[model samples]
Target: MMRNKIIEMRGIVKSYYLGTPNELEILHGIDLDVYEGEFLSIIGASGSGKSTLMNILGALDRPTKGHYYLDHLPMENVRDDGLSQIRNKKIGFVFQTFNLIPRSTALKNVALPMLYGGVPRSERSRRAAELLQLVEMSGRSHHRPNELSGGQKQRVAIARAMANNPAIILADEPTGALDTHTGRLVMDIFHRLHQEQGKTIILITHNAELAEETERTIRLRDGSIVDNRMNGHYQLEACNESV
Candidate 1:
């Protein structure tokens, strides 16, 4: 069967301070394709432009010169509102900070995406509860972020990412802020999600060890793709080990 490409980016160039004397270029003409249900990782150093690429991929920012087709929709010329809608409907983000509302309960945080998507209140609550259960945070549903551990907060963020059933789950250094045990557990959740839910996941991290666990790894260097390789093996046991 021919695999469907969920994300297609070609000649993706991102620059800042355009038309200014102090202009700087970040991503230097990137080309990438991610198929549906694939587990992929992009690993890079501090100045490799991983964040810039991610922002463009997540539709949070536009590229200076490039063509990005996310789920077959052209993202290059999309308006801000259109991009916002695309982000809500097609992309789920899991950030290092967990990005949950401090005052909201875990359930409320998980339900926020659904709320923005205009899901009915009854259905939203039901799905949010289900997602929390998926991430093993059902018991903490009523607790706020301040009351949760780092791992717990990350799990809640994961649940929220699944709220809209997005085309892709973009995880940016998801395990960066947790302890070894907690990070391993978080990684396990991602592995389970990919195997069980068949989520199309793209992980962005600077850890080479973590990147190797994914099905494919793309290495960036100074704003350019230095290496792109398919690991073929999932390395589940290896991923279970600490990074």
Candidate 2:
């Protein structure tokens, strides 16, 4: 059986301040494919264009050249409104900073995306509560962002991101702000989402060790893929022996 390709990028070139004295091409003619229900980690050092690729994949930014097909829809020529709609419907982003509204309750924060999608107030609240419960933050639903710990805040953010049931979940340095213990918990949540919920997760991180946890790791260097390994089922002993 042939599985569906959830994301496809061909000859993607993204540049900042184009045609100016300070013009910088961050991504250079990159091509990649991400499939449904696959957990892929994009690993790279600082300033290696991994973030630029992520921004393009999430529809947060446009590529200066080439095409991006997300869930079979080409985003190369999409207007801002169309891009925004595609992002809201097909992609969910989890940022390192959590990006939650400080003044709003966790439930309200999670419900905000659905509200923007015009979901009714009553139904959105119901769905928000369910999502909060899934992230083990139901008890803190009424608490504001300032009242929660970093991990709790991230859990709320995860629930909020899932509110729209997006096809792809783009997590950019999701555990960057957490302690090791909290980071493990967050990764465990993501693991469950990938394994149990069967979500197509794209995790962008600078940490190589973190990439080991995903099903496949694509290492980027100087705006290109240095290595792509599908070592999803590698034994710990085998990895240690190879090391």
Candidate 3:
């Protein structure tokens, strides 16, 4: 079976200040394609334009030039309102900061996205509970962010990201703040999501070791992709207990 293209970027050029003297180009005519159900990483150092590309991929920003086809929709022409809808419906984001509301319980934080999507009160609560269970955070459903440890907070964040059942999960520096063992636990969850649930995942990270765990990697340097490679699965001893 031929896999569908979830993302296609052609002639992608991102620039700041289009016509002014301070105009700076970040991504230079980059072309790329991401297929459905694939696990891939975008690896780059600081100032490599990875962040700029991430914003474009997430539909938070548009390319200064070129066509961005996300799920076959032309993103360059999408208005802010339309893009907002796409972000809410099509992409799940997991960040290093665990961007949860400090005062909201784990259940409430997981339910927040569905609430924005206008899911009914009962359905939201039910689905949020399910998502927390999937992330193995069911026991902490009533805990606030301040009450959880770093890894626990991240698990809650991942659950919240999965609430809307978005087609793609975009994780940026997901394990950056964790110790080695905790990072392994988080990576294992992502692996299960891709292998078991068939979720398409794009991880943006500077950690080469972490990137190697994914099936493939696109390495960026100085606004260009320097290397794209398929990786052998590197094994790490993950916690046998639930995340």
lDDT of 2 by residue, 12-100 (tens): 99888856698888888898989899899999999999988998999989999998899999887799999889888898899999999
Model 1 worst lDDT run, 10 consecutive residues? 234-243
What is each predicted model's overall lDDT from 0 to 1?
0.94, 0.91, 0.90
Q: Which portions of model 3 show Cα errors greater than 4 Å?
A: 233-243
Query: Per-residue CA lDDT of candidate 1, range 1-243, in tens?
Result: 567999999999988996769889999999999999999999999989999999999999999998999999988778988998999999999999999999999999999988989999999999999999999999999999999999999999999999999999999999999988999999999999999999999999998888888998999999999998877455553355434
> Per-residue CA lDDT of candidate 3, range 1-243, in tens?
467999999989999996778889999988888989989899999999999999999988989999999898888678888998888888998998989999899999999989888899999999999999998999999999999999999999998888888888999999999988999999999999999999999999999999988977999998998897677732221122122
* Candidate 3 lowest-lDDT run of ten: 234-243
Off by over 4 Å in 2: 18-22, 234-243
Q: TM-scores of the models, in the given order?
A: 0.95, 0.94, 0.94
- Please give the TM-score that candidate 3 achieves against the real structure: 0.94
Check candidate 3 and list the clashing pairs.
none
Q: How would you order the candidates by TM-score, starting with the best?
A: 1, 2, 3
**Ten residues in sequence with the least summed lDDT for candidate 2:** 232-241
